[model samples]
Target: MDLPQLGTNLLNRVPPRLLSAAERYLKSVPLLRNRLEKETDSMLAGLEGDLKPYRGQLPTFATLPTQGLSHEQVLGEMSQMKEKEEHRWKDGLVSGAVYHGDSEHIDFLNRVYALNSQSNPLHADLWPSATKFEAEVVAMTAHMLGATEANAGRPPEQHICGALSSGGTESIMLAMKTYRDWARETKGITRPEMVAPSTAHTAFDKAAHYFGIKMVRVPVGPDYRADVKATRKALNRNTIVIIGSAPSFPHGTIDPIEELSELARKRRIGFHTDACLGGFVLPWARKLGYPVPEFDFRLPGVTSMSADTHKFGYAAKGTSVVLYRGTALRSHQYFTATEWPGGIYFSPTFSGSRPGALIAAAWASLVSTGEEGYLDATRRILETADAIKRGIRAIPGLHVLGEPLFVIAFGSDIVDIYKVMERMSARGWSLNGLHKPAAVHICVTQRHTQPGVAERFLEDLRAAVEHVRANPGEKGTMAPVYGMAGTVPFRGILSDLLKKYMDLLYKV
Candidate 1:
């Protein structure tokens, strides 16, 4: 029989769970395992060549060369790689990686980094400037998120405060760990749980796995916003925190933070507003008269928030801000050790010796792009996003998933959206393919706001949709993988495939 007939026979013969287990066992057999290994090796061999293009051209350094390479040689190699990689992002053919690609800003930040490359925030006395930058970054981010209003009459310890983390994942993990500890100590609850929307970032799940907290995910409503009533039902005495997103990463739909936080507030539990994607944009979007909701400390219920300075803030990578309603709650995130062989030791985030240059870069980005600059940038990004959304809606069989600002997700009723995404990839557009609803999205940034970028994107997208509609039988690359990953009954098999793929990343 053919592939379709076989698939139908398998589905008609047995339940999915048993079939999944049997397939898993069959794949574990020696002959099948060998075939799998051969296929994986062949695939990775192609990826290896692409990842290490200079392997044959450059001198090998399995062990560092007997003598050090000259600075000129190192710079030449790096410059070559940079030249090769910068064109796509610089010319606006990609998605959300490079937020601010202006050469002047990059050069300015590089100068700041060079001046402070030797500094380390772990040694406060050695780098007082780093401490100043860190404190100010936190303060400025807090003030932008309504700290001044939240702490109007509060004491310093009871006022909004936080620390700088490497990125959004670290910030979120830090908050989750803090709540787990706080709940255990203050409420004497051994079992800890946190409620969050289904659209919440995977970092929360990672936090739950790492910190031993139970994560309860409440599904979103028809509009793709969090279901506040469902979230209320998911809470219990053991619920230490509740979470909402200010424009989630997948669909970019802002949750009903006001209601969710109010629910948490009435229960006297922590409420974390994950604004990692929107923290820098929404504040300005609200100022621009966008329909933004209360997802900050201005609400009495919100106790914590995570924002990425790297994304829309136009800061360098390796910097994010996690703010708490009060310093007392943030104190639980601190790590201190008094019994070390050396002197006392303490750290606010995960890393022991953090790079001060990144802190300086973050500070410089914020200072250079003040309120006026951010507002202008947000305006451009939103306008570009609006154009893309409108264009997608106009295309036949395609519909915008939800009301989004900078990140717009679209799906199709008559064609496989993944196939369309594959066609878009072929046309030099790198978009995010989302599952569950099987859609795709492009996160508009400063790069996309450049002249003709939005029009080109829409034109290519329309052509791709028409092509997919004409060639319905053509199974393009990556579409089947996406389809299988999304619809497969054996989730464990997919998880294993991911693990193997990650392992390949480390292979030299």
Candidate 2:
């Protein structure tokens, strides 16, 4: 217990021998467990201030008030908070939070939401419009992702079809569950595992934990694409599915889905390309003649995909698409019950009752922002992303990672990137911190493509990098946290700290 121990099970498809033994030895000690808990609590205390910005402001409520507050009061307080938050994201100072922030688009989606506020897809028998909207949204998404070409000779049951989930995480989790069930029933694989690139979304990890699916994380190649050879070697008889990202969240580099999927094809296993961040952007980027790699239904091996309608689809937040190559595969994602007290019920997604208003807004966004709309948006976004990339690379200390179309991560050799990130935050720019090799990223969206937005970003970034370079010994905000996150080999301590952070998130 003197040293940190690793978690058991497959880390990068299999655990390190020393880690596995260490994990067991340390886990047996009572004092180590207690000390770990105390350390995690202390680490979480450091993050509490940032997590709870309104801790001392406003009238906080851990539970609903005995009587509801006046609507005007609620509105006033919410408006104030929104105003505080809006400036950062609205002015294009943050990364990946807001996609399309044009007031016209925002107003339009808001109107759509208000119109269908009471609608619920669970009672689709009553709200058929919701059903219609969701169906069309799926169909529209499929067509854009090459489903038409892939399903040319296939039956409707074998055509690309999907359901709407709350977000990217839900879409991903549902897909993993579907794969687990599909593999078990069809392929006689009792034990299920999913193989994914190291750069793949963490939602896959969540899925693995949630549905008892073993996740095999394989390393990415030098190009930051999935190592197809390594993936093949990692796959076992129980591996139900393989995954590659259409420009994964971290590196923003598209995995070689064509090659990866073909490997999955040869093995007769499902291949899922998670385009959560890139799905809505990539097709348009490709059409715009950007150097986009093949990472879609065009590949015969891509059996499933997840695309965030909320991210690049310009929909309100709470919507995402999870598509299967065929209804047969998607059917496994559905949950059905019969002979219950609540008589003969079925839910297409995880939630029994779903907010149809978001789906309505999603539908509206897709239709209103037609092919032309997407083309224009992608054009601006790509241009801005290109500019940002150029600026980052031009910086003396920084270097860009991989050939990325939109979401960009840059690392520094001369300054602590995390400290630079902290400096950016003080200047009202929020960004993401990355590790393994320390770096930071900004996932560019339409918001970032606004006039002067990219230029302003580079200006702030240069100043921030300079500030960090000037202040050598200064332990800037979040730098210590990031450093601890990266250097702390005790994953149990990190995971426990993360849990406490989550607990703070739920604090009223």
Candidate 3:
């Protein structure tokens, strides 16, 4: 066995605390640190070309130009780059980056953005329209996610309410922070913790790290959904909330939200349904006769939810909605600084000065798309996803990970899935690579609903799988990297590698 693999195996046998100490000590050693730096630098060097493709092609700016470039010149350069990069997503060759890529929708949103370019929701006095747009966006999203049903016989203050966020990550982080504050104040829980399935999004982990909350992740069930028994066992007095996904990112399987939320309700703890992926689709999916479980505010135990307007909502890229069961819980998410010299500052979300243009775009997308538009879009996307799932299952060695509606994950017992992903990449397809079972997923979007896109994807995927099976000995550029990432026991090493990659992104 290779030396690194052997070392990883040895480390895996060590106790958790001791292993962490050993990892720290190993990094403290100058020689070991230097060797790691050299290897990381070399690996990053290989990726620099693809990441910085315009290095030699376009003008590089270490600092600003002596004088500002003409608007025409700037637009020309941007247009060139846009044309070069648009094809992959335009043709549905990518996974989830661009959701609704229709020209008319894009143009409409662009116009809305341009019109509200100077509006800032932070300065509501100056731009009441921005606030109107944001409030309506939140209300519209909340109603769609069962706020109306949840509001039945309840006071307005107890009705479902929400705030506009930049995206899903912010919405999730906002809810987590809100829960942390709420638990600390109401439950008197000094040390906060959250219980979630292993399939919950990494944003929860980020929130835990940032907010000083302990994250307890339980194992998923055989069907790739959250294990209720395991989740119940993981909860404790310190658990501020329980998290369930409407449809998880990796496996595209919805956790048993009903049972999970009930557990939280019985405990009197918060239950957050992260519907960021399925929020816009599942509600419509259920209306279209799909088996979507109760995951919204309609569930009594569901105290909060996050829905991205950017993903399936057909909004422009930057807006999402985070809802609370009542105004009281949402109050914990607010930030008000009366002590500041800036004259009683207050902000709803993380950012103080927010892009009201994106809010306007989100509002515009929702109002324009309406219910029928979302239903039609959801129908096409789910139908396309069904076809894709069938095709993946038909591929001899591959199997769909779960019974998914739109987002589809697949794996193979007979082939190196990572190698198959690499082959797909070579054929100009961009797909998400998932680990902890090692699979790949395609988040079916409206782009994939276009004519022949599903068929094209299946054809390319079949060819890629056959190629991987026929040439088992062939080395792949990213396949080995993905393989190592999935199997390596030393998570700290991989984390460091990712940090270095993030550094590389800022290197220009």
Question: Best candidate per lDDT, number?
Answer: 3
* lDDT string, candidate 3, 301-383, tens digits: 99999999999998998888999999999999999999877699999999999998999999999999999999999999999
Clashing pairs in 3: none
Write the residue-wise lDDT of candidate 1 on 1-508 in tens digits: 7996477456646876787887789678999878866765555565566566777776656677778889999999889888888998998988898998999988998998898898899999999999999999999999999999999988888789999999999999999999999999999989999999889999999999999999999999988999989998999999999999998999999999999999999999999999999999999999999999888999999999999999988888879999998777888999999999998999999999999999999999999899999999999999999989989999999999989888899998799999999899889888899987889989899999999999999999999999999999998757876887666655665676667767766655
Q: Which ten residues in a row have the lowest lDDT in candidate 2?
A: 1-10
lDDT of 1 at 388: 90
Worst 10 residues of 3 by lDDT: 481-490
List ranges where model 3 is wrong by over 4 Å: 1-13
Q: Report lDDT (Cα) of residue 412, candidate 2.
A: 86
Error of 1 at 481 (Å): 2.2
Quote the positional error of residue 328 for candidate 3 in Å.
0.6
Checking candidate 2 for backbone clashes, the offending pairs are: none
Tell me which of candidates 1 and 3 scores higher on TM-score.
3
Q: What are the lDDT scores of the predictions, listed in order?
A: 0.90, 0.89, 0.92
Structural similarity to truth (TM-score) of each candidate: 0.94, 0.94, 0.97
